[model samples]
Target: MSRLRTHYPLRATILEGRFFQLSENEILHSISLEYTSELTRLHSAYSIPEPDHPRPEISSPSFRIYGTEYDEVNRTLVGVLALRWIHFNDYESFVGCQPNSVKLRPQSFNWICNIYRKTIKSNEDLFTLITSTVINDLGKAPSLTTDYAKLTGTDINKVNHDMILYQVIHHPAVAETLVPSLTKVSSEHKHDLSLGIKLGAEFNFGQLAQAENVPACLSGLKTDLKNNPRAFEMRFMEQLLDIAGAAGHTDYTCARKLVEPIFDSYKNVYDVAIDIISGNLGLREGYDIILIRRVELLQRVGWKRAESLNIRDKEKRALMRLLCIGGAASIKTADLYYQTFTAVNLSRTVYEGLVEGLNVDGSLEQPAVQPTYLPAMCGLAIANTANGTTGEKMKALTALLTYLSRVLVIDKDSLSFKRLPEGVIVVERDLRQTIQPILESAAFKHKPDILTDAPMPRDQVAKMADGYEWSFTAISI
Candidate 1:
């Protein structure tokens, strides 16, 4: 057994108000003291900010320390994963956390709690919250999978966890006790609740299992279907909880803020693209310099491996930088542009159907203007990772240029994307004219004498073009 499991009994006893028994064994007393110290240290490292209103007294029996069949060890693992390392074995659920224990509350957590307390007011609501938290992972157990597969006379490997959950929850023996607890939810909603849970699990696990095969944008589509019309908040809740749980293990970092809130007040992705074309000093000097330096830096590293760039933010300046690079690449290699569009968001099986030349087999014509290239933008970020190819990076830069000329969005929201009407496509001549001055200016900053080398001999034009084609205006800087 794991060390956690071995110590579960002692931990459970202490949590269940048997603290008086700790002095019986000298070793146990020492262990208790050590545990207490760890809790204190954790609280110091991960203290939560005080919320506006006092936190509710969460006295539900479901939140009790030792009621569920899930032992303290398993609960601790779950707690660490979804609860920001707030161990279930430490106290009587989240609301009853000890003063010294770390609480993992963020702004999002407070918003969720407020909604739950004000809107959801029934025994069934409580059950929905509890079961979604604890029992959601029941299908993940190997033993359970084996037993379930045997019962259904199916191959264990072929039995998906979601399918197993759907069956187990509705099983005659289990449903007899489990189904009635959802007293307030209608029959239709009860079904949605189960499906939402299944979809949420898939949303979490599928991303890990099929990272390369699945597009990042479409990773949550399955869950979103359940959440359409905002009918099933439980799905979103489960996803958040699962991420919180696993965050204890994952080394997540925030992206660099490329656009401040005031500056980020763009109409949409397309608006940002237009702003890039208009060319602010920051765009020319800041973003352009970063791209040029980044590409050169990557080229020097040669292609052993590439780590994924942290390019997931929706800030305008960041989006503009992406649009400038990836869009330009797509135009330079229209075939690659089309190939990337077809390959993006399509399932792994569908992508395999495309011919090697990447000719679109269907009757779908090349879009007259820019299509929503959000997925491709995201894919480019992934391609820039340590393992990414030189060709992929080059393609990304070229595509960004194309985006500067031909971006559009229907949505007004800056945080999310929505497709709009076809925008004017900036051709190669226009792009070169607009970008050349900026590149020269950038070169001048690093080497003041760059202009002196003006109107370079004809022999050097092809070399410069080659450099620009691959890395987009390779300034020496």
Candidate 2:
């Protein structure tokens, strides 16, 4: 019943035997013209450069149109997301698009036809050449080269990680794999990765469903073992990662990069023998896997709420800045140092647990060196988002130090934290007086759940992981 429909204006020209160049600028321009700030990623979006050099950069300026802005700049993925948006529709079978030709507009229809020698007949072939050009171009980006060199991990590993993040994880097919086997999904909630993605794309184009019904679309996504009885045990983790990434969780990019490494770590550290490819982890209900999987629910709920009500991305960032500030406060309270492992006191049981957890192979390798401070590092990453420049970072830090000094914690040798306040301050003085207004500046009339939801399961896992590390570092345990 909606007045607007999805289509491609270019399908006719290509059908007439005339090849066209797929100009990146033209495609982005059409998107800008058709979509609104609420529809697409107006600020901070996913970008895919190439299928070969697959790294999903947090892109921007997809081409500034008339006056409004669209964020996220990946020629390949953006184009595909746009294509899906044009082609997909409400029917569960997805029957709304023009069957023969893409709905490319005349002015913006040119794609990379010059490189083709054979007639590019199938839509797939054209897609391939177009994305290849994007990937080749992306591989050559100055920022990519710089960032590639700077990764502490090897270049090959970095590219591999990026490929997994963009290509393997974000593949439209990966989500589709779940459909046939998806179990216990209600009539209204029969969501697979394919549908969720299509819905998200539609949402990006400002075709989001009403707020309340959005849950039905996402309910099929939430992983209740009872609901999805036929769930593939092994693919669950990857599916979760894909869903979460698609739905927009903060640390997913890093999570995807660490997937294989973390799998190896789990095998080594916790002795979790998970075979990722075969979908066979000997254990039933691995909490680590669950920890990763449940985040999709958080992202789905949060994103639906935000998009349904048309909340702007800036407001989201402002809220995230506040959350990061809170994270910084917790990290500061712990006084956890990452520079070098300093001795710390822990209770006997805590120490014993650390010994057991850290020393899976009986030998305590670098017992004194506990890298349990990754959570704090996560915190720092969040807090740093408040400022971009050296001056701004300095100011934020100053503001933080000023705020923390006000909390009445017992000072202990400037090394260990002995609690005095015995409770979280909830909000510091500076944050309450100055920061709160900035975050809530533009009223976000949406559900606000995305801004406020906590990853309870992830937090528990983090706690356990940190506790194990603390056991290693404990001065007394």
Write down the TM-score of every candidate. 0.33, 0.26
Candidate 1 residue spans exceeding 4 A from truth: 1-109, 171-192, 201-231, 248-477
* lDDT score, candidate 2, position 12: 29
C-alpha local distance difference test of each model: 0.32, 0.25
Each prediction's Cα RMSD? 20.8, 21.5
Clashes of each: 30, 14
Model 2 whole-model lDDT (C-alpha atoms): 0.25
C-alpha lDDT of residue 7 in model 1: 64
RMSD of 1: 20.8
Q: Best candidate per TM-score, number?
A: 1
Best by lDDT: 1
Model 1 alpha-carbon miss at residue 216, Å = 13
Question: What TM-score does model 2 achieve against the real structure?
Answer: 0.26
